[model samples]
Target: MAPTGIVLLDTYLPTSDEIAAILPELIGDMFEPPDGIAHLEQLRLTAMGRYFRMFGDWNPNPVSAPKLFVRPGDPLREHHREVAWRAGWPLPHHSADVGGNHFTMMSEGAATTAEAISRWIDALRH
Candidate 1:
């Protein structure tokens, strides 16, 4: 989705450990190598024990602006989009299909996905 105001552009969320690891490749536009390193450092600063504990306590209730743009779109993307559409504002954009791979893209398709995003952003700006 387009950002609501002049300040925020989009939200980048990496939900699982595997996805987080591949995130640098998937969403390279958002950060430089240094930024990725910094994010890793920040993640390390948090205690793993505390992080694991939150899994059981997680709750579904929330009230806030919708976060947009989920990457590495797979079957799960459509599922979540359906849920979000029912709940409130549907997500604005999903990651490119990339030849339907749940795992990392295979060279040509990855480039295709990247190009798609570039075009999408350019279109949004104009």
Candidate 2:
């Protein structure tokens, strides 16, 4: 994105490897069509192809304004957090281990996600 404003990333993974890495977990965790694997294959292909086409390079770019990176609260899943930071994406000035996985953070953990984001923004305003 054209860096210009405040940002809140909920497990903002930007690479195919990141997507692929979590595929195993996602296979059974999501509500998909009977052809779940097929659907995921399409998603996987997009991560590998369409993502780069739309986003330019994998290189990290500078981001201005306040930033926050919130992730699933699962302690065992901490490695994703580590991987995220190492991707050269603009580092979040603030970080948190919130609730739910990458996708659940939007649905099952939507409330938690909202609260976390709200707190982040409130802190930024102060």
Candidate 3:
């Protein structure tokens, strides 16, 4: 929460430009489909829009439902873990990290992620 006690808002970040600019530097650790650069470019505005425009007055601080924060295990995304831990979700909040970059985690690491989910589900059930 911000000083106003509303949901914390980011006025400065969520720039796709910065991520696009740094892709080459992080190439070794990324997985890409055909025409990845073009795909990124095609998605720049829409991707940035979620933060750049749409989230002006949103509140997610009191997320009531159980939270399952499955984070992408990209080195660049390590902050996700810190954020999740800091968010301090409800008692049964669960989290895990599967290998791969954010997008790649959907493909290359999907099985691992799925297994993590299944385990979490089983744990909850038990």
Order the candidates by TM-score, highest first.
2, 3, 1
Q: Tell me the tens digit of each residue's lDDT in model 3 across 19-113.
A: 44434434433334342222445366466556546644443355454446665555344543433222222234456767765556567777987
- Compare candidates 2 and 3 on lDDT and give the better one: 2
Of the candidates shown, which would achieve the greatest TM-score relative to the real structure? 2
Per-residue lDDT of model 2, residues 1-126, tens digit only: 644335455533445465555555454443352321234566675674575486544654556666666666642245656653321234656776667655566766779888988887787668
Candidate 2 lDDT score at position 83: 52
> TM-score of model 3 relative to the true fold?
0.49
Model 3, residue 30: C-alpha shift (Å): 12
Q: Which candidate number would show the highest lDDT if scored against the true structure? A: 2
lDDT, residue 109, model 2: 73
lDDT at residue 108 of model 3 (Cα atoms): 71
TM-score for each candidate, following the candidate numbering: 0.30, 0.57, 0.49
Colliding pairs, model 2: none
Candidate 2, after superposition: displacement of residue 115 in Å? Answer: 0.4
Q: Please, what are the lDDT tens digits per residue for candidate 1 over residues 1-126?
A: 644322112222224444344444433422333221223234543543354466434433433433323233442234433332211112343333344233233333467556656665665567
Candidate 3 or 2, higher TM-score: 2
